[model samples]
Structure formats: structure tokens, C-alpha cells
Target: MIKLELIVQVHQLKKQGFKVAAIARKCNLSRTTVYEYLEMDFEEACRWVNELRTREKKLDPYKNQILSWLKEHPDLSASQVSDWLEERCSFTNVGDSTVRSYVRELRELYHIPKTISFRSYEALEELPKGKQTQVDFGEKKVRTTKNKWKKLYVIAFVLSHSRYKYAEWQEHPFTTRDVIRSHENAFEYFGGVTEEIVYDQDKLMIVSENGGDIIYTEEFQAYKQQRGFSVYLCRAADPESKGKIENVVKFIKNNFAKNRVFHQIESWNEQCLAWLDRKGNYQVHNTIKKRPIEVFTLEKLHLREVSYPLSFESNHGSSITRTVHKDNIIKYKSNRYSVPLGTYKPHGDNTVYIRIEQEKLIIQKTPEGVTVATHPLSTGVGQLIKNSDHTRDKSKGIKAYMDTVKESFDNSEEIELFLQEIHKRYPRYIRDQLQIIQRSLRDYGPFVEQALDTCINQRLWSANDLHDVSIHLAKLSEKEIPAVLRDIPLTEASSELIKEKASVRELDGYLRILGGA
Candidate 1:
């Protein structure tokens, strides 16, 4: 079939005294095909082409295979299918545009959706004043927010009853410290905190969930005591329960964000705070039908008043133990710091207790807790923190080396039990397994001791099993360090309070003595 314009051109060429063969050659068509259009009008040409163009397409051969693939993997995209055809099915000539068009038509014919749909939920009931507040985090990409396109996260806190909202923006993801600090600011913004606050199972707060049990993060568990409030974690996979905060996150992005200009993040935060005062909290809420500031009056009565910001203080005379390596060094937070050359005997029985005193690393002898070495804590990870005096006497005598080996294999109950169990259970491989345990101890120190105990108790047969257990335990130990003071119940208010207070005083006394020295 030929185009109407081509038919007109052919007739025009024929009228110019050109032969049918000449017209066919000039128009790039067969003489017989050119004759079909020579005497036809424009409408007749279009009708002729339309009549036969409905014939089968090249994709008809693989229609069944493509449909089966789409049904099995709804997420498989058109371009991906095209690439799959090129590589797997030898359909190298297949175009993405053709595939997409066919896929769209297939979707319409088969009732297959292009994307998954979620049911939108709206809150029907409202909790009483101070009974609940919702919390969540949101991210935004902004062009004017910084000198370049910047990605920022906003932590939003919303009162479920009053609809009062508090939001803080940061240039980076919210860390545990940032979460605690944001709560302080939010409470201050609302003038107090609710009795029970709802959360979206955020990692900064919730560590893990087992069935119905929720394990809060180590730092947040401490903050719960300091601030004295009930924590309400939303169920996993149930996003609808925390709908209020989610909407607040969107409201912030839309009203305060769209078409808005920003120069600095700090200035943006200040602007956000001002906007909340003038527009966010001040405006009449669509659901509650009252200003958040006015509704907060009733909620404020049940809310907890803040006397001080409840932030996690890492250590207060608390200690963490690490084993010294053969190189007269110990590992802490990805950095290695040196101890005295003879500090670690090959025996590996000795332990070092580190107290993070302000900005300094106070390394002390375990059991006695005597200050043995100190170095300013390293600022960067993967760095070697060294003290020249600690490296003296690298060339010790043979007897000294023998004694070093003897000391390492002594004093550890964990190592002793591991050897005993190895001898009783697998006497033939005892030497090899003992060597593995010693290697684990030299590398991981006291951290691997608990794992060895678990491995022995469980009768795990191989050295690799013990090593795996040790590594798992080491990770848990690291997670335990976002420290806060443990809360002891004050039954005897005066006496129990003194005990809690005493720990802080003890830390102070140690610091004072060190300060004098």
C-alpha cells in the first residue's frame, strides 16, 4: 500500500509524460504496485493501505511466552523484557517501544495492574489530650535548600489529640543522638511531652521485634527512664496505625516546601519553626477543627514537663574490656592504639579496661582497674594511634617469650572450659581447636569469651562454629555501647537515690584524682 501523497506524486509524474516504469523507479516501488496507485485518488490510497495493514505482527509468535512471563513476574519491566528477548530468545530486533505498547494492551486485556495498590486509611477516633502523639521521619530533595541539590531528613512529632506538630530538619539521616535531641526540642516546642508517644518502628528507637515483644534500642531504653513516658511502637507492616504523623510529614513538604526558597539548612530550620508558629500550629486543623496551640491547653496538663534535656551520656566510670595484641596494641572503634611492649604476654590472660573520659581514652588494668595507659581518642576510623614509649624492648629474651606464652594460656575461665570440653568431647582435635580458640582470643579478646562458652555449651563441633558464635557476640557487644545510666527503682527514695547518685560522684572522684596528677 502506498501513501496518499505518494499516489498524488505518481499521478503528477505520469501527467509529466513519465512512463509507469520510470514512476516506479523514481518512487521506489514495483511497477505493478505503482500502477495500483496511478489512477487512485488520495482517499482510495489511504483505504487500500488501511485494509491490509491489520495483518499479524512479528510479536505474535512469542505472545504466549511474553504473557506467561508478565503473569509470573509483574515487576519485570518492558525494557527488561526486551533485553531478555535479545539475550535469551534470539529476538534481537525487538524494540522497547513495541514491547511497551504490547504490554499496555496486554494489561488492559488481562486486567493486570502496572503497579501494586495500597488502601488509604483515615483515623476515625481521636485519643484524649496528652494520651498520644505520633512520630516519624521524612526526606526531601530540594534545589534551593543549599548551594547544590541537597537531600535532607525531617523528624516530625504530632500530638494525636490536639494535632500540635513539631518538626526538625537535618542535612543527614537521624542518628540516635539526633533522635534524642529532636525529642527534647519537640517537647520544648509543644511545652511538654505526651504520656504515650507512637513511633513507626524506626531503627533509631526500636532495635528488633519478636512476635509481640518490641526491644527498644539501648540508648532509647535509657531515655524512657530519664523522661518517664510510655513508648507505643506501631506494628511492623502496619503503616496505617501511624497515619497522623505520615500525613503531617506530607503537609510539611507541600505547604512549607513547594516552590519555597532556602539558602542554608540552619536558616531553613529557623524558617520552618517560624512557619509552624504562624501557620502550622496556629491554623485550625482540618480534622480536629481547632487551632493546635489552643487544643494543646488541655493536653498540656497530662504532658510531662521537662527540667533538663534527656540525652544519653556514654560512660560514667563504666568500663569496656579489650585484649592487647602481639604488636602491643588494642582495637577500639576501628582504630588501634598501643600499650607497653610487655603489656600483652603471649598467654593473653590480661585484659585492658577503657573508660572514655571526655575526649581522652583512659586505658586501665582490668580487675584492679588501675590507669595503665592513656591516649587522646582518635578522631578518624582505621587509624593507628601510637605512643612511642609503649614500643620499647622489642628484642626480649627467649625466657621472656616463653613466660609470655604461658601467661596467655592461663587465668581465663572461658579458655579453660573450652579446652576441658574439647578434651572430653573431641580429644583427637583438641590441639587444633585450642589453637583456634587462642587465635580467636588474640584477635577478639574478652568479646569472644562469651561466644566460646555458648559454643561449648551447645557442643558446636568445629573451630569455625566457635568463630561464628564469637563474631555474632562481638556485634551485640558493639550495639550495647550507646550507653545511658541504668535506672534503679527508688523504693527507699532517700537511700536508693543516694546509690544512683553515688555512681556519678564516684566517676567525679576518679576524674579529680586524675586531674590532680
Candidate 2:
């Protein structure tokens, strides 16, 4: 048996960069146990170590002998063994419970009996007044407006002390908003709230749980904080912990709802409430020998009255408020979904509430909460869904538009090669320079060819080089240059003129070719 200190040291040595074997050596524990404690988080390991103290069981002494006896005589019953023990052995103080417990353990270890066996149960102790309430939701098949069967939901709240109950029915499922409204209605019906409410791992509330830690849904967590009530969720596969509301649900269905037709949710609830007042609350004298409503009056002093209406809305609603991104799209689940043109105003306090339902994403403007756009939900992640009428799409920035305009120019090939060279050399200036090039093409027209050709001859990659060339092109677009400027000396004009390789041909060679060759 390992001491509790070894488990703590195993975790400590692992945190200090020790290998598994080294930690095992340091803690004097087997590598398997060390690995197990390591796999557990620090808090889990601490809890497991703290629970190591052994408390003796009453049947611990005879557990092994009972197993051997059951192995030899597989048909022996626990009650028969109890009678034999009292008559034969000196265990006269041993009651049937101790013998039965030992027999149960032996049967499990040896598998000597059938699959089913006797089980023990204890009745739940009733809680004090205003102490606890159990809540649960149930579904029933109902004939709907479409003249077909559909499932309607019922939420039941039952006080554990008095067995008094409150219930509401709805035509469809309960959204988080509907859950809050139902809670408000239930509290209003009881005229007060209990200190704690028990539930059965409801999805509207609990997302997941690990051991003692609970991860609640965002909306439910907010509701818990706002309502100022303690929450208790039954463990997985343990419905009996929240059995009160379960019984209320069954009672509501069996007695009031089974053979009855559900006309509509409102009328059914009105009729159901009247029935609860008359039959359910007024005549409940079974366990306590007093009416549930009469006992509920005594519990009311301990219960807290609803001081204000709860306004805590859950984010789990199909609709949620989200800030529009710079690209005029709202992001949900790592995907950028689109909206209509002008739906998002830059730097304005505008936001939109997005609702996803039935493969459709609805974008509604906030404050007014009007529907602005709708699109089919995309199947991929990190994608941009666009509407055709949307304006100023930042996803396709100005550079893509500039690419299209550049394709229309006659000198586009030379311009592309030049721009690629510029971009590779000075990537940071590409956007500014691309804008300048596009303006030259659009405003200066065919003269950009002259600018690009001049840039090619000068071996210059600067946009300034193109800028100077574009200025000259723009001047020439007005009219031809004056002759005085055009007829400069060769040396001076050669500096500014298009650079062509010089070629010399002798006149003597030409004359010989004409006559005496």
C-alpha cells in the first residue's frame, strides 16, 4: 500500500521535468501508478490521495470465507446462511444485513449466480421547507395545426418538502429564452422560490461534467448567477436524485393529459392549471396526511418571493448579438458569413444579431433588430459567404479590381512584368504603387504605354521613375511637344530620348556597292 505522500511527490517530480522512471524512483511508486497519477490533473490526484484512508467495513472479516462457501455451494441463499451462522458459529451478534452484504460481495466476485439478484433501497428523506425543488422537462405527442402528430414539451417544477408542483406546456421545444420564461412562470405560480433547484443534466443548462466539476451552458450559467439560486444536477445515469420532478411529469401525463385532447398550448395549460388546483393540490393527503396546498402555506414563510422579473437572456438563442467585422461580415464558429450591401457601416455603433435555423443564416440589424440578409449555411470553415448586391467587399480588395483593369490595357504584359519586379523588390509599397498605376491607366489612357516603355529602357523599378514618365505622357496627351525642345543637340537629347544601340555605316562602302564593287 502506497502512502499519500508518494502520490503528491509523484506529481511534484513530474512538474520538475523528471522522466517517468525517475519520478517513480523518487516517489518509490510503480511506473504504472505514477503514470496514472500523472494522467490525472493536479486537483484530481490530490483528491485521490486524500481519500486513501481506509475505514473498516463490518463484513470485511468474513468476506473471503463467504466467497469460498458460495463457490462450493452455488445454490445457498444469503438468508439461509444467516440462519446457519446464528445456530452453528458464535457470530450471534451478526445480523442478516451483514451476512447479506458478504453474500452479495461473494456473488459478484465468483459470478456463481444468475444475472439478477436481490437489491437494497432506502427511501429519500424529505427536505425542509423552502429547501429544494426538482425541475425537469417532458415531451408528449400532440395533434398540431398541421393536422399531424408533433411533440410538445412540458416543464414541471416540484417542491421537495410539500410535494406541491407547477407545470407549463409549449407547442415546440424550449429555447433558452423559453426556459427562463418558464422558470419565471413557475416561480410566479409558487409565489416564491426555493433555496436550491435540482435537475437532470439538462442540455439547456449543463454542457458537460467531469467528476465534481460542472461545465454549464453560457446562458444557464448567467441565469444561475442572476437568479441567485443554488443549482444541483444529478449525476450521469442517476435519475432518482431528481425524482420529484420526474414523478410530477409522469403524473401530469398519466392523470390529466393521457386521454385528453390538446386543443392548443394556452388552452391546455389553462385547463391543466385548473385541474392541478382542484384535484392535485387540494387532495394530497397520502404521505404527509395533509393537503399539499395547506402544507405549502407553511413552507411559504421560508421561500423568497420574486422581487423582480428576470431579464437574463441566453446567448444560446438562435439569435445572438455580434459585432460586424471590418469586412462587412459577422464571424460565427470560425466562419465569416456574409450580409447585404451597406449592412455594416464603418466606425458606426451598428451591430447585427445573427440567427441560424434550418440551414439558413439570418442577419438582423440590432437596436431595430430588422432582418437585413440571409444566406445558406456553408459547410466549410474560415470561408467568406458573399451576396451579389453587397458593396465594397473587403474580401476582394482593390488589388483584385486593379488586376481586372490592368488586363484591359494594350501594354498590359510589359506593365505586369514591371509591376511584378516592383512588388518583389519593395513588397510594402505594392499597394500604393498599384493604385498609382491603375490611375495612370484609367486617366492617362494609351499614354501609359509610353511611361512603361521609358521605364523599361531606363532600368528603373521605382514608381517615381514611372511617375516622371507618366507626367511626360500626360503632357504629350494635351498636344505634341514644341519643335525647339524636340530638336536639342544629340548629346543633350540622347539623355532624354529613347535609348537605342548606335549603328555606324561608312559612305565609302555604300558608294563601292553602287559602282565598282
Each candidate's number of clashing pairs is 5, 0
**Candidate 1 lDDT by residue in tens digits, 7-95:** 88998999899999778878998999888887688777788768645667777788888889889888778888888788878997767
RMSD of 1: 28.7
Candidate 1 stretches greater than 4 Å from native: 1-101, 105-123, 144-146, 258-261, 311-517
TM-score of each: 0.47, 0.46
Model 2 compared with the native: what TM-score? Answer: 0.46
Candidate 1: minimum summed lDDT over ten consecutive residues — where?
310-319
lDDT of 2 by residue, 1-517 (tens): 2445566677788778999976776667789988887777757766665664345666667667666667777878898777766666645667787778668756876677833465476887779999998999988876555655656778888888998888888765565567777888888889889999998886667767788798876767888888889989899888878867777899888887764766777798999899889977787647778888998989988898888876443332344556676667887655777775566554243456767779988888752467777888888988888776565444356458557756855777777788778877865466677777777767776777788888988878966777778888788756755776677666867666657667989989988999965
Q: Which stretch of 10 consecutive residues in model 2 shows the poorest summed lDDT?
A: 311-320
